[model samples]
Target: MPLKGSDSDDGGNDDLARLLSGKHAGKHRRRSRDADDDVNGFPRLRSPRPRDEEEPATPTSRRFQHRRRRGFVLCLRTPTAVVLSSAALWILFYALSLEGGDLVSIVARLGILGAYLFLSIALFVLAVLVAVFAKGIPRKTRGGLLAGLAGTCVALLIYDHDESLYHHGGYNALIFALVVMPSLAVGAAEIAIWKWLGARRAAMCHLFALFVAIFVVSARLSRAAAIWGRGFGGETMQPLARTCKPTKIGLPWVDLLPAGAQNFWAGGLTCAPAAKPFSAEIDADGALRVKCPSNDATYIPLPVTREWPQDWKLVEENYEGKLPQPFNKRVMDAIRRTEPFRIRGDNAPGMLVPRTAEAAIVTCDGVEKLVLRARRSNDTSSRTLRPPEQMTGSRQTKTLDVIVVFLDATSRRHFHRRLGRTVKKLEQANADGRTRLFQFFRYSISGFSTGPNSRAMFTGTSPNNLDTVSPVWEDFARARFVTAITADTCQDWGASYNPRPAFHFDHEMYAPFCHADFFAEDSNPLGNFRGPYAINARCLKGSRVSDLALQYAGSVSSAYPDRNTFVLAWLLEGHEGTGEVLADLDDGLVSLLGSLDWSKTALVIAADHGLHMGLNFAFTRNGAVEHRNPMLAFALPPWLADSEGRGETLKANAHKMVSGLDVYATLRGLGKVVDPTGFDDPDVRKRAQGGKNLMEEIVPPDRLCSDAGVPQWYCECY
Candidate 1:
């Protein structure tokens, strides 16, 4: 305590009262007057002046002064706590998201952190500045400071919309909703909280920590449930080719052409040419081995297409044309001359006498040829194989006419090029053959591919070598003389371009003709022919389309069409995502199949590839890759099964691995399609070996030929 009136000299009369109490107030006042007279430094022993000379200060004024000082102190401590707490919370939430936390936890953490940080920081900085510098200042000073700080925060949110802050760990929506919006609300609350607390730093700190703790608990539980409760394998993706060794070996019993068979120079089935031939071999490790000769065909014709046979489209085209010295186009020329029909239908005459109805033959010549029978057609009976000459049911016994339907359902542009080359080779066989010739032959190719005039393979010279190459639609269309109808197909339907658009999956218009007769069956003969047949390599070959047609045309009024003479069509719908197109094609097939006469018609369903839809890779390797399975199916006429001259049966443990190319061989056995060798091998129907045969295990037992009710040739439950 320095002399009370000594300091009071600077503060005015009010400070004199504050420094002195009771009797000291009067003494202090008297000394202040005397001290003023001395003035230079501390008062010397000044004589006491009369107290009447001093004036008194009011208590209200003194109280106001003290409050102003206290307010300043509170502002300093409170604002700092608010701001620091806010910053810490923001950092915590950011870290959690970056650490790959569960989505629910990430969101909850963000919300809690945002609330704490915004409230604390906003209040702290504003209150401290106001208390420190704005004492007795205009209201505009505090308002301007707070408004500026808030504006800065708003700008941050807008600027960060596209930043990683918004998208980290799949938190795009959460950031915008929780972090950004709640920030504004918390900011306002913080300003109010600071002002009410009079810049109490301790209170703001407590509030922020309390908020954070509550959210932390909530976030932890949410994260736990999101991560551990549900499985991540719901969506299975295809494994990358890099992970697995590509297996090139097909079934041994099936006798499939090797991957790069063109380089092979074989004298017979087993004899190799004396010269070393070029070939491609794929080892078990998914590695490719290619041996090239010094002089080889250089110009490999690459097929370009606009639309893929299915929903796929072509986006790129690349080809290098290199021509080698004339190796005989003669072998190719010879095969071109020998044309054999490759269609899906029946091709032989029946030997069994009908017990229920007259026998008939719906020939490919558009003539309904009738076979006078000794018995009714409806009788549960057998039919023997009639000689080729006896198929006409006439004295002259000419070759019988039969229609063949070919489906080329490929969803990718690459497959189109391959299938095109196969068709062209078939035309070559036609040009080379002299014995089997037909006048009214038509091969109509329809599906989604790149174009109407494209070939199916990358090159006709050595196709097996080009299996690694991607396919295009035009390659297949131009290969054979057959005409094709391609839809607006492409390689990819912009799935990579804009994945989240409202209507991203709109490429559903490329399905084949939707007809009921082709797939379904009604009682009408002429009006029921409708078909849904589009080609997509991605779908489950012929069976998928058949199933689709069944769904579209099936109803309570009629059962599936029982046809014997009609050749129905098929489309791979699932591969293309063409929902409407699939529905239409199925309806078309049903109507078409229904209109056909069952007694004189035969329908066959087939597939090019089996999809790997059932694998549970997520259980083992997480969601990684997709694979393809082998094709499988077989059909025989009901009449042939009852009256077979020799009752030959397919193997019991059939691997059920039927190759798509085997359809051609099967046609040759039926005699409707002509093979120059005219050789029929019963063993062709043997199951493919190696993998578990999906068809053998899945097909109903009653449908097998070995069943007592099933005919030898006809494998059906009925």
Candidate 2:
């Protein structure tokens, strides 16, 4: 298209040619331009000539000129391009997540393991098929692109699977910048290099440019990895409490008590003289929990750190070659999938404990103290009450005291909101300066209400299953340990699936107290219910019901100081009204803990779920949070508490999603920990198929809701 000669009459085109001809070429440019050469399709220009003699350029020629700047054109007859591009994107996404790229997908939110398998298997197969069958693109070009795709896939497959990545579903543009456009660009460079990338110097320049592009990509990837590491922990990944958006009061780091709206006379369990009067105070346990603490009596707590008693022989578990059973599908769906939960008690008649603690007192009427044993003989228990035949020599083994303090309708957040003082006091309690109370922030619920949830938690099976052989309490009893349970209401008893829990216990405080029904008209504190144990009914005959249970349990524990005991006190005062009333009972809780024989006591202060009612509608959304996020705190002495032993594992697991099954599993293992030969029976020695001990075994980071026996509907962690 250039002219052969130049003249004054050549016009503007000639002038432009004249301007560029001399400086554009080297000394040999004139000689070399005599003939046309397709050197990597690089354009060539001749010395200036007359414009009248030059040939005009055509559209095709103009288009061909761009060939040097572009690479191979990947023409396709089918949607091969679309398929490969899509696969590439998927591979990129996975790679970023695995390699800590900009688009890291957290295991908790993405169910990363399952999704990773899908991408690795499905996408990889699809890509291979496209590579083999697709037509139109050059073989070399196809091979090169396929190589890149395969490399990306392999790289992703081998990338470390770290569950620490917190959920952050953003960074889509990174995929384009990393894979899509760069792909097109690399192809162009390849085509230019393979076809004659100009002279040696020009080829080197193009090579250098490609190297720079690669360096930039590597730098970007490094930055992405850094971002991934920064927000990995549950504590580091700040929770976005959408419920607090309008109120600006849900920040966790700041004081959360004010958020409870406790200033309302309606809030916080008040200890003021009752507006009305009744009797029955100053019981010994009551004295320990209330009077003694109020009067500042010289507190003498039981020694917690001591060698195992010489009289009680220690038993050891045997597990030379055993494996835990896997959870099956049927149990996973015991509840619906993908729905949220509610925290409450449904309509359940009562438990099947013999005539209640009332019978022990020689009258159908209730007594202030109905003393009884916690474990019932199997012969007296219903046929459903079968324990793994009292795990070989369990009776001879010495066990630790296991006390469970269950707070109905209490969420972890609500625990913080209502019992901030208790939380602080427990946090301060320690073994050699290490924290004593391990709080499980990621604890989740298995049901909306009390019935099914209790069954799941107590039995470690589907909540729907009516019959269970090893209720945790029963297991303790079978192992020659004393077990007892006291509750404010019978509706939410752990074994609610039965019209009356099929299996009966040795002692019965719930039935006796509830059936006693000693109440002042309209005194119920639990909302509209006017009888007994309502959200608003703070006291029964002037004694705080919450403190009463604690005192009773303490008294029972003291009754058999020589033997290990398992007592559960289900407190309900903190069960409703934003649950702020619990704040008033913090002192009682501290006193109870102070009196415990920490040396042998392993306490679990947990809740089935939270009660979302009470307070203003501002907390309506916050109520949803309370629904699934129940309170789960484990208070163990330095020795047994660190069964994760190092504290590292326990601390890590506290952040991962935990459920009732894990608690059940932990209970099952206590026998082995306390009395060596305790619960290591052949059937249970391998651990329950669906449960895991939170303190001992580490829960897999990639564990799914189903894996933990949490139905999809009730699953809130992911």
Candidate 3:
């Protein structure tokens, strides 16, 4: 099409090439208004081209032809202009990444920003007049524009995220109206000035000027409507109006001690001395009663009181009616009955006081001594304080959203690095801090001790402090958290470990021997690469383990409500590195994830510790030196998937080493509070519990692997 009326005027399909062609260059260019040029320059038409060479037509006929042609061309151009402008606006809106809600908000907020923009443009136009007389005006003008661009870039780097830029669909269209319209207005004014100054040609400049004016008017009108619609739609709530939920999961008891007894148990001691064995028993009324079993135990009884600390209350209905306080018979027996001692003297409070003389109340001197105290008491001054009760918040204005993607264990280093990087990206994307979330932990089973006691205290803490350690307790303080909620184990025992190979938490294992599904890391392991739950009595002799896993996931998902507070558990069955494990986990995991409201909860999956596959392919010798196993799988809420600091790349495959500890930092980040107290463990503490160091420590640049083969794949395996 030719540049004007004919197809040739618009030129060939090469739009850009046709635009720059010399044939229509004059129309697009500005006629230089030099000192010699007239205000309305006219050229003599080739000396009238020898007057006789031209033919003349009747006035009426000529007038009719001109009017008809003009009408035809105008009609054609109108639709073309509308189509081109609409397409351009759409591209701009998409590039800017606008969403519908954001678009509406922008329109509403636009009024606030629009007034400033208009005033700014007016000032800019006014300043042009001043610039005409000022020396070095061009340099100053360029400097100001450059400075604005620089500031925008910096602000974006500091606070903007990919997620925020997106509007569900038409949001950005709304934003385009708010932003583009005013911008075009300013641009049009500049173009018009250039045209009048003879710096640009009237034809091309006029076309562009037309384009800008039309868009500006259209965008402003559209954006205004969007903004007004949303504001008029509803009322807004303050952040404080929202309340929190019960943060603690399982309730643990708090301990109290009798009066004066505190002094007798001091001196760096944990229990009462053997000489003065203090015993406690729950009375018929369910109140705790204490007795001194020491000879010459004439010490004053301390004031003993009971108070439920906070979160450690029974959640079930069966154990109602105020479950026996901490000093119950079970605890009393665990403390004193195990130790042997005989009382030689009465340390009882009543035994220390003297009786009144002949039913007459005899009062002593000003001191009014109530008793003549006995001697030879054992001094115990140490006191033990119980952990506080669980914390609760009012109804939440926001809820924690979660996504857990369990990955196969490959290279230890690669896994850890990938795990850490994924978590960092997820946290950065959720800067809103309105959600409480955590990723699957990257732990190995070998690091933990076995047996009922060890299982009860299951965690990756030093052995010496097992009785006093609880990672979950710390996590509750940092983020409302739960782990190993699944019911699968990743370990595979051979004929040697157990003749009739048993699952990690089989009926037998969950009996008196060990009932620690919540605490044990292996309680919920991943499925073997090939089949369902490791053991299915219903299956025939040779069923695939992957099938069992899938069935189990289906059963569990079906058993629970899709919405509610509960942990969905999974155990990757088997320690082998066979490819089957990955396939099985993915299938089962995909199913489980599909069943939840990912926007309101989080999913975390990791191993207790990893197991070593024997070269012989049968369970035999255990490997002492463990690799830095990768902590596989972490998913976050969809909204947070694009938060700032979330790296540009995403993990695609199943090979990377990511540290397990990143779990703590990731959870802290999701919880929205920069400093989470529970991450006080030496490792996570330095980052999360302190300052803004969590991002630095958890998502250091080294963790991202933007290599061609794995743009988001970390390869730090040994």
Candidate 4:
């Protein structure tokens, strides 16, 4: 039986019975009580206590309640929300930091604005599905999705790293840290969020949805700002028309040729052979001897005259110019029918005049010498002229040989590190007066590329067009110097003004002159080598180009020890690879230099451009900075270094602003060629044409890009 005044009494009895039985009781019996009594069977007593009189909560109970509330808030705070917010901030920062112009161009170039919008919408839908069907998604499927996202992010980091951005050290480090660290945090937070959603611990999945929305909005805003600020998708401003007066005078000799002949002479005859003096019989009157080997032809001799006739009356009267022969007909018709033949001067050299043209005015060493034309004949090649005896011979007092070693893409920084010891030894020898051979020089820029830079070095002018003449080799050849070139890379010549057979060099060798079908049979028998190093071990061990160049140089030096020699070895090993290739180059150069007699040689060691390696970050920028500033050093012979204060001047100018043009000018100066002005004037500086002799004059501080022949597109200097 159970006794109870209300349900409370029944519950109390049930609890007691459960405790005694150690099991739940099936039912409890009720016991009746007086209405005045309480549930515990006591008399119905006192009135209810006032609210202010109630006992306070215990410390332990308060703490437990507080912790419960805090836990509820924690459950609502989704990790996904925090990660999304962080990612948004990072993306915003990154987008804003990009160049506005570059961003706008990127949008126009990729043509992906609509696709990007679609991707955003698709991502939003995916996020919605993730929130709504989180519980339904299999554990493995969710994991795979997360893994794919992580992989995509990693790939983006690797593939999309901006080289331009990375070059700016402070911004690069900050942006990299922000992007990578937050990306990792986002991945971790995603895992936590997925677990929470699966376990039904998330209080509000809508928080993640809200975060995704914010992220997308921020990203879009950033991108839009970048594009708008860049000012892309706008019309380009038309350049203002400018009126310029021609500053340079046209050559008198150039004006003498017909329009077609002028074009042919300028374009097609770059390497035409110089005319040699033929046997001639002078008359008793000193200058009136005319003899033709063909048909034993003879014309009446004219009065001996040192000065060219101011008028063509004498020329027309003496040389049967009135005749209607195939050769004389054109000359007579050109003289009489066309504009008056303006005779600029007399005494032009036979070698400087063109043989095929109807007429030409030849000049050499700033002296106009002759006005002449080829006689009528079926064979145009068969032309004869007697050159003055005074014009031939070495112009320089002492024979000076030149060796230009072009290490492709060898950075100055790397050069100093790998070849510092050898260079130091040479410097020490010079300092101790043991050798006066090595003199290290510096250039401010290497020009835009190998082609332009090499052209600038070869010709004393900027490489704007193919018409630019590289007269240095021809000058050397004219002075009886043996000229030769050996190169591992032929692309440089192909890209620039293609080397002409006559003027560029007396001998030229290309590494890949033959087909490689029998490479295994001839060289790399093992067949393990590939890429640029696919040649035989012997060739790779010593540098094939350098070895061949040295052999050629040796042969020329030996054969023409008395005559000057010019040899150019363009080694390709430095274009790529680590220190090993550089080491090979270093050793080869050492051997080559050791074998050469430095006393009579002027050695120029340089690179067309610097290497793109870990070092040389300053010069690795995208614009002209990277292309400029290559390694240039000079080794002058003792004879050339004998000028008073010359050594000190060279040392002082080593760090001065210089270019390949100056190198060209200096080489010309050494070869004793006078400027067109007729004087070997060191003070007459033609900065644009690169006619300033580096050996004689210093570059001014106020030189502008225009003065240096640098195009506006490539000019970085203010």
Evaluated with TM-score, which candidate comes out highest?
2
Best by lDDT: 2
Tens-place lDDT per residue, model 4, 426-543, is 5654665544542322354435456667666766557564444534666665555566665543222422343433343444443221113211222322121322322222242112
Please give, for residues 636-678, the per-residue lDDT of candidate 3 as tens digits. Answer: 4544434453422222112222343344334445444312443
lDDT of each: 0.28, 0.50, 0.30, 0.43
Model 4 scores worst on lDDT over the 10 consecutive residues at 228-237
- Relative to the true structure, candidate 4 reaches a TM of 0.44
Displacement of residue 603 (Cα, Å) in model 2 is: 0.8
List candidate 1 stretches off by more than 4 Å.
Answer: 1-570, 577-585, 612-627, 630-634, 642-655, 672-718
Instruction: Give Cα distance to truth, residue 255, candidate 4, Å.
Output: 56
TM-scores, all models, native as reference: 0.25, 0.48, 0.27, 0.44
Off by over 4 Å in 2: 1-268, 271-399, 431-435, 464-469, 490-495, 499-502, 515-537, 615-620, 642-646, 680-688
For model 4, the stretches where C-alpha displacement exceeds 4 angstroms are: 1-397, 432-442, 490-496, 499-504, 511-555, 577-581, 612-626, 673-688, 712-718
Against the true structure, what is every candidate's RMSD?
26.2, 22.0, 30.4, 25.2
